[model samples]
Target chain A: MENIILTSSPTTPYFPEVSFDIDKGICEIRGESYMEETYKFYLPLINWIKDYIKLIKKPLVLDIKLIYLNTSSTKCVLDILEILKDYEDDSGQVKVNWYYDKSDPDMIDEVEDFEAESGIKIELKEF
Target chain B: MTSKTILSYKGPFYIELISVFGTNIRNFNDTYSNARKKLFKIFIELSQNVSNYSENFHMVNNVQRIGVGELFLKELDTAYCFTTINQVKRTDAEILAERCEIVNASDQMKLRELKREQRLNSPGEKFGARIGLIQAVMLSKNQLEYKVENINENFSYFSLTVKIDKY
Candidate 1:
């Protein structure tokens, strides 16, 4: 599978900066997410994750470094997590790391919520 | 006097309010990058509350809605106060009052925990109803204050204010 790379923009919508390297099996989603059309932006990313789970059986590492994300974006993030959780359930090795500013307690709780909802163990890293 | 005359007299006041609000937004450049993004999100959520759930008349065109309300952002010595005023039905006013009371009564840590629980339980499609107030309070990292002004006995005007610390 090919790698997916997209830069985050403020003017248009909340499309997070994404880099999914098929060879390395490292996917990083960072930056702020508050898009007007959330589903449209996130559908491709979800599809890509599903494709990766099917085609590539390598150990996957998903890193989240989002600073600010709206409620709509949060649902899409959950969707991505559910995909990862399914892959993990099927014997695929998966690790999810959520990096947040140490000062921001709200973000920490948000990450924890994602972990609880998806039933995925997300490693919280303070930065 | 005629209705047209009355509207014409009120036109300049409306123009002045818009100009002032625009100027406030324009002059807001303290820490434009991150703070601006946060401000935009907060404003969108708060204003949309007035549009979607408020009993007041809100203009809807396509998927976008605009509500008649006043938003003020004032910079103090150490923080900024963001205030919004709009009309709401009595039931909405009661709900908002209860939510604001709960938010104001809780500490930061408690609020964070509450938000986490709510986020996990919230169904994906429904937005702007449950989490908006909580999100606004959390985003500002400050307490929320709300007041209800009785507009007759059936409806009321709700005012909410959130303060953001400058860091």
Candidate 2:
């Protein structure tokens, strides 16, 4: 029920800043995710989304503006998208947007692939 | 050692080492921003693979921990080559060699499709779909070259190399 807000740290740029507002139905994950133990970091966020979709029953908007994310974190992102996909399947309103650096084609390809694989429409924007 | 050698680290592949090496590479003057991102991404994926799966380990403070490996970055005329060497069980070496071969032969589209398939089918596996190799190949935008050398009956040394063109 409480919103999760984590400030960004320069020392461990791998861990991103996560802001999930329970009331606003807006979740934003920004920064590089290169955590050594990725599973431990992502499980809670995944559970939180599941809780929001089930308990809040409100429209959700997920915004991701990440500079870098490793393969494990990529898997986590996919897990999050899969959750959103399932929510949409159940007639729950869900929207996802990925803001990627225009210079990084790899990031763009990744977002497109995620959209294709998850069967969830992700609005891709370049900035 | 070649005069083109930019940097090299040989020893236990700790988790934090990846970020340290990445930061240094990012600060290199010759590396363009896009290329630097790709370089760092490939470096982390390859190095972490060594950290997570390398079979060789050294005991520290009465605890057996993940083993050691070597990472080297060398400059060429127009590209920078990143290479990692680590110890693996024979079975893992065989699996990794086969995966590298598969990745080496695929074009970008095929690689993308393969990554998507792996992500969808095995997303929750301990290593999260084991897509590290594919991601490295995608970011490096080059073929993966690897060699598996017999170290002993039980283990073999696996070396993987990816080259990123410096622009």
Model 2 error, position B94 (Å): 1.5
Which 10-residue span in candidate 1 chain B carries the lowest summed lDDT?
B2-11
lDDT of 2 by residue, B43-93 (tens): 888888887778876656875365589989987877889999999999989
TM-score, predicted candidate 1 vs. hidden true structure = 0.69
Q: After superposition, how far is residue A65 of candidate 2 from its true place, in Å?
A: 0.9
Which segments of model 2 are wrong by more than 4 Å? Answer: B1-3, B58-65, B123-125
Error of 1 at A119 (Å): 4.1
Superposed by TM-score, candidate 2 places the C-alpha of residue A102 at a distance from the truth, in angstroms, of: 0.8
lDDT accuracy of residue B161 in candidate 1:
79
Cα-based TM-score, every candidate: 0.69, 0.94
TM-score of the first chain in candidate 2 relative to the native first chain: 0.97
Tell me the chain A TM-score of model 1. Answer: 0.93
Pairs clashing within candidate 1: none
